[model samples]
Target chain A: MNPTACLLVIGNEILSGRTQDVNVQYIARRLSETGITLSEVRIIPDIRAVIVRTVTEARAAYDNVFTTGGIGPTHDDITSACVAESFGVPWVHHAETFRLLEAHFAPGEFNAARQRMATMPQGAVPIRNSVSVAPGFSMGNVHVMAGVPRIMRAMFEEVLPTLPHGTPVTSRAWHATGLYEGALAAPLEAIQNHYPTIDIGSYPYRLDETQRGVCLLCKGTDAQAVSAAATAVRDMIARLGFEPYEGEPAKS
Target chain B: MNPTACLLVIGNEILSGRTQDVNVQYIARRLSETGITLSEVRIIPDIRAVIVRTVTEARAAYDNVFTTGGIGPTHDDITSACVAESFGVPWVHHAETFRLLEAHFAPGEFNAARQRMATMPQGAVPIRNSVSVAPGFSMGNVHVMAGVPRIMRAMFEEVLPTLPHGTPVTSRAWHATGLYEGALAAPLEAIQNHYPTIDIGSYPYRLDETQRGVCLLCKGTDAQAVSAAATAVRDMIARLGFEPYEGEPAKS
Candidate 1:
């Protein structure tokens, strides 16, 4: 089995329904692209105890953990301190991160407000943030990043080149129009039974106001198994006198 | 402490980044509108064991537990059955629910695919779905609904009127346009100290592409206290000679 990861989305705004959690999807897709399955995602409020407990538990369980949000300059931005507390590490200044912060702001502008970005856990590696000076930090098995979508994506890009690569994640999907799930169940089950390594998923979607179709998605590392299962699905649809369109294959 | 709620978003598609978890934000905001505090949210894969474990734990802890997703006609739509099994109940069709479903779906349209939607655990009350025939079911401590945002929100509307009401959740927000967070830190802490019941939050937003400002938000059941805290924040901003534009007034 490859290394699995978990995401911890921390913010009161998320829980309060004021802000949408964009980081989860951003991280999940990026992790999947790297062949690291995002096993679980837990969203906790900005409470220090809860954040610490969640960080501790996630690090203990998952191969690697990523946390987003609560790293800003606001009073509620306690994720860095909380993560440091969880690891029992002292808050220290990262020389590189400090330089980045200084470069981001004018001489006098880099005051306490901007200095808050430099306070990282002891021995933590700074995750370079290209959009802003407030860099994310990584320690042990946890990689913490900004909550904003652009910043989070940038941080992930910066950190991706440094992490160990795993298996190549691949997927093939075929869409069978005008057919319901029941019509495809038996064939789908047979295909699933034959190719247990390839995960077969049937998503029923309503499109064009009146049309309905089931998009059979096959995902796994084994390309032969994925193609085989997808072929079986297309054959089943053809047998039913329906035109099965193999959707545009995802970018490699 | 008032009654609280938790949302369990069950879908592998969400975790895989194919589908974003919109139900959590909608449910949380809707619950807050009805005075129910949304304390926690968890997103797990469509696996039955994970769903059962998360559902069981959340139901035992929160006052009300609402789950979205996994109630469709596809093979992965196992949330309804798993939820029934978790509560030790047999999934049976209720006469009233069947009638409602029948009324929605014409004669032969309610086939096996649609029939799966009508099946519910024993002693479950049907949540009305204004948009579709696939009605959500509420059994014991858990409410299971569709993953689609529109259907979920409509089902929640029908379900909300039935749950017991709690404290009226209210909020006040004051925007400190383009002011640094450090400038308001001391006064913000004083405001928090003055109003223990109200939770205050500061959000930094980039302005005109350069300067940033912190929006101080005060949220609580007590309108007077929330307003007072907002006023205190506004006064402090004025004393600092920064033009603080009050955003939208307190809302429930």
Candidate 2:
């Protein structure tokens, strides 16, 4: 069985519809490459109780739990403290981080607000990133990172090397225009039954008024099985008299 | 208090990083317009126990639970059956949907695979949409929707009228290019504390190498309080050296 992971995107901005999140996709893609099955993702609020309860539960549930957002210097940035509460640890200032951040700012510029960024859960190992001087940290299996896509990616890159990996998932897709999902479903299910290890998916997409099609994808940890199932899908599409094209058809 | 909502995006495509979901933002925006508080969103895989457990929990925890994906004719489309299990209801054929879908298809085309789309949990009301002949359904407070954005939006529109609404949440923003979050945190926190009814948020962004800024926003269900807090934020921005600009600066 593959090692599983979960992502917690903690921010009100995402839930408010003010920000369209790109972090989930970025992390998902990276996790796929690293052979960690990202089984679940939750976009949650910054409420104290919610953060504490969610972090506690998720850390226990998945092999790895990643949290992004709510680690800034602002008042609403309570993730570090909340995570501490979640793990039943003291929220304390890391001496090295404190010294580094204090020096980064001018003598008077490093106020209580800025100091908040340096505080972390006890026993956390700092995740150094190229994007920011301030560090994200890992407490046990839970990795907490910044919300900004650049900083988050950098922190995640640091965390990626430390995670346990499974066999990388492989996929192959065959698409064609004018192929309807209803018409394609039966044959696709038969193919899926033949390869129990493979997951066969039928996705119908319409790019424009004239461009529309069904994309059949075969995905699994077994690379050869995925490729073979995809070949069967292509043959099925050909038998249906629609031209089967390899890979995703368009940007949809 | 506003009626809270939870969105579940159920599909392997999303988890696999193969699809970028647009349904959450659409549903969030629509829910906000209707005065429903969209508090959480979970992207979960199309596993039977996971779907059943998540749907059951979400329906109880929030006033409305909206689910997108897995309502297709394909083998991977297991959401309906899982949802039925979640509610402890018999997965029975919806007569109206069956009749409608059967009529939509040609002779011998409405096979078992296609028939899966017409079946639903007992007591489910069909949610009709203009985009597709196959109907999504609402069982209790859990609204099952299509994964495709167009179809999901259409189904959500139909579900909107049936939900209970609260006061619409309003927002206002003030931004400045040179203002830093650390320097502004104290004043922002004071402003936030002064207006307990409003939520004041400071978001930093970089349009390019040279054009970077912080956007301060005030949001609340109380329109007057939100406006008052926004004016205070605008003043605070102007009090600093940088010229305060109104509204979001760019597409970001």
List where candidate 2 sits over 4 angstroms from the true fold: none
Clashes of 2: 0
Tell how far residue B8 is off in model 1, in angstroms: 1.0
User: What TM-score would chain B of candidate 2 score versus the native chain B?
Assistant: 0.98
Best by DockQ: 2
Backbone clash pairs for candidate 1 read none
Judged by DockQ cut-offs, is candidate 1 incorrect, acceptable, medium or high?
medium
Tens digit of lDDT per residue, candidate 2, span B57-114?
9999999999999999888899999989998999989998999989988999898889
The sequence of per-residue lDDT tens digits that candidate 1 reaches over residues B1-252 is 667888888887888887767788888787777788888888888788888888888899898999988887666788998888889889887778777767876677666656777888888888877776768989986888888777888988888888887877788787766577766776787788888888898876766566667778889888889899889988988888887787842221
- The Cα error of candidate 2 at residue B216, in Å, is 1.0
Show what share of the native A-B interface contacts model 1 retains. Answer: 0.59
